[model samples]
Target: MSEIVLRNVCKEYEKGNFAVKDFSLDIHDQEFIIFVGPSGCGKSTTLRMIAGLEDISDGELWIDDQLCNYFDPKDRGLSMVFQNYALYPNMTVYGNLAFALKVRKASKSEIDEKVHKVARILEIEHLLDRKPAALSGGQKQRVAIGSAIIRRPKAFLMDEPLSNLDAKLRAQMRIELAKLHKELETTIIYVTHDQTEAMTLGTRIVVMKDGVVQQVETPIELYNHPVNLFVAGFIGSPSMNFFQAHVTEENGRMVVFIGNPKDGKKIYLEGRRSELARLRAMDQDVTLGIRPEDIHEYADAAELGIEKATVGMNVTVTAREMLGAEVFLYFDEQKKTHAVRLHPKNQTMTGEKIDLYFDPKKIHLFDQNTEESIFYREETV
Candidate 1:
């Protein structure tokens, strides 16, 4: 079992300036963990600290109950796959795959067997005899992975291994990597800035910002119940929409007005959500958060029994994207552009007026000053 733990880990480049601050996580064995954030958020630095490539300024690094903060990278038993295919141009794929084993003085037969086995698993057997320069981008990546697999390390640390590939190739490789993780059944800690990769690949994703970990959760949980405004805004493509809102008690129900109270753009909260919001934000300003898919058209609103609550939300379509499977409509509200996903048959053209409704149950409320989700459950964190 390759359980890795970081206890209040930090990386300081200058006095009082940390690249990674108070980062702590317990990574389970064979779990595909992803560290994801925007660039310069200290994700890569945290990965490097785990890999022993960078020094941990504070806190403890433990690998399987052994303190490993001072261990050499090679002795830590972790294989690293970098973004750049770090294969030797002068060496063929087979040679590159066998290099690690040969460095340990393994016999030729053992090296050959392991090399062939890994090549078959990565589907690079046909390119074994070709040098790095002769292989395509995908092929070279496969070779790089095969090289790492031959060592049979305790865990794999990958730093944006597919960032260089095009969109189509990246999609294909994502599938391949998932299959590889299952077959190998080894711990993998991958780092990437792409949310799509994090959502699809990781069993548990670590969302970081400015050297601090914001939340760690499964993809669906993170998407559905983000802990704060930053996470809700960061995880999804086109992200969550936010509007200035105020919460008040109206007719024995908690009501959230989207803009000015006179505009009639408001949503009604019911049952437990109403109780929670009323307890935390009654008669206070809050930010209203809703996903694009949660905002629906007239027919859907009627079906969901939220029609009256959406009475006066009239927005002019500024942009319309017909993405075949689903339609996306963009509109301006309170000087901010908001998006809504509709059925592909949504005939709302650019410059046309459209009425949209929010599903009351799907609404999220955040504290205006703290930006923390008022409805976030502490148990999930």
Candidate 2:
């Protein structure tokens, strides 16, 4: 329903601690933008600033194309759903939903209509007469959301609204929230530390760390093509494995050196010869990044390029997780360990050793200093 923009926004507390710094983002109308990062990453603080709950120490805040730096929270036409379901325990669900309108002395018929409409949308109409103590956690959360919805504000700001729910209920609420977004068509700014929630719910994700915005893109784009080491490591499950490697020219070809002098191995990457050449020319030591799923067990070493520089290393399988369709193989090799995703059929017993191959094309190379992707080209093949 409204666009929110932050231009060079910053927040600083006593002792020169910066909570958020030089942050600028444009959230379009009806878009669900999720701010995600680890705790103390300034995501919640940023949301509070946008909601007019915190003063902007620097820069401008705009809502619906209007400068809202000095505006009151209510006058900004934004509704916020907090992490804790801040429902009045004494009030029934309907009363909780009607409180805001009652404070403004809205007509009795108008209040009833708005509250019931929101309850119906949230599917909590049956629980309207029940107090918070009588409602389940999910029901209470729905009432909290309904309270925000009844206001019909220009935008919705939710800060980890489903954090208190159980895992199963969380999943259900996630779907319901997505449905709510579609039905309301209002700009939503949600904050969460959970990567799964951020990935599944966001139309565009703003990945932040240490008070700085790392990447702002679609979920798939961030997952497939992260901008830096932090985003790469933070955005995925079972996180991408990182190995310090040196880039060297071997026989007119670029290769990344993996493993140490003791039980060492060298992996050669075929594509992006030009990019590797540039990095090598600059004498840069690159970090090799590969997702667990990208490393595959070779059925026939001769069928592929596995013989070129493959090293025979002994891995002690520590644990195996079977997820029906796929299995996770966790193992240790040469004092270093990693998780390799494999078919459920390939679920090797603990202490068993298996041969695995790393796909060069699926590997990512990042500049050691800048931590930016240097070897992976974005142009579609």
Candidate 3:
């Protein structure tokens, strides 16, 4: 296994468009690192640079402590699996897997041994004699992976290898890929635009946007404690709820304004006095962020300090989705649409007005100007 590191790496096209800009990251030995972002983000370009498929305009590329900026792709000791399952249609699965060995003038017996071993590891031994034409989409992908693994490269670069699979098959293959990583124990750098795949498959995820690295962290950490508004908005499934708000002292308490215009509401925050004072002193115009799951149906407003900020408009429930034990309530609130997760037992009506309770401690605050998180610190408990 080998560690891959990129320091101040950059990729620029002739059009003066920078695909990747001063990118720097270290992929530890045997670590599964995923590069994830939206389309047109530099994820694929970054992966291509590591694979030696694209030239690094400026900066260093290191593999196993060796500077490899100019190393040929074959000499990098890495194998890449592309999105399209680049298999030769004329060759059988076994032949495809053994092609590299054959080109290197290995004995037929040696090639056969390597092919069968990889097929067995990938659980595609039964399909060894079948051509790419006869294989299913998932099977073709497995063969592609098998071919990459047979080389025994120090690192694997997978670029959205599962993108073509169906939803059900994608989930199944995700599990299989994770299992394969454990068995092989080789360094892997996967690139994808799918946040779900990045969150589920990667040991660590690097979120990127506009050719710049945003945040890199474990899946749970990224979900719970994103570094900025962009990371917070991009990483979550439902996408975190953001409200433009002002931080002000009200009734001797530091509160965040919802600024609804029609009927503004103030949500009191529960945090250290010092922190609140610091925020106040900075004159920071904060953006209040809350996850849909954090907002609950107000059962007893009196008990939770929930106050009726207004009763201007009743939100009409547009749709309701029952997700087993819980139901997702999609409704229009105060001219803005919002999603709320509620118990399946609570049969809320479509046109009924519901009071939502916001948990102050679970709230996130962001700097309005910088769009950076202001309430992120290592938790004590």
Q: Judged by TM-score relative to the true structure, which candidate is superior, 1 or 3?
A: 1
Candidate maximizing lDDT: 1
Alpha-carbon lDDT, every model: 0.92, 0.83, 0.81
lDDT of 2: 0.83
| Candidate that scores best on TM-score | 1
Task: Report the Cα lDDT for residue 63, model 2.
Answer: 86
lDDT of 1 by residue, 47-134 (tens): 9999999999999999999999999999999999999979988999999999999999999999999999999999988888898999
In terms of lDDT, which candidate is stronger, 1 or 2?
A: 1
What's model 2's lDDT at 85?
88
Q: Report how far off residue 73 is in candidate 1 (Å).
A: 0.4
Candidate 1 lDDT trough over 10 residues, lowest sum: 372-381
lDDT digits (tens) for residues 206-244 of candidate 2? 999999999999999888888888889998889888876
lDDT per residue, candidate 3, 201-245, as tens digits? 889999999999998888888888888899988987777777776
TM-scores for all candidates: the values are 0.98, 0.92, 0.91
TM-score of 1: 0.98
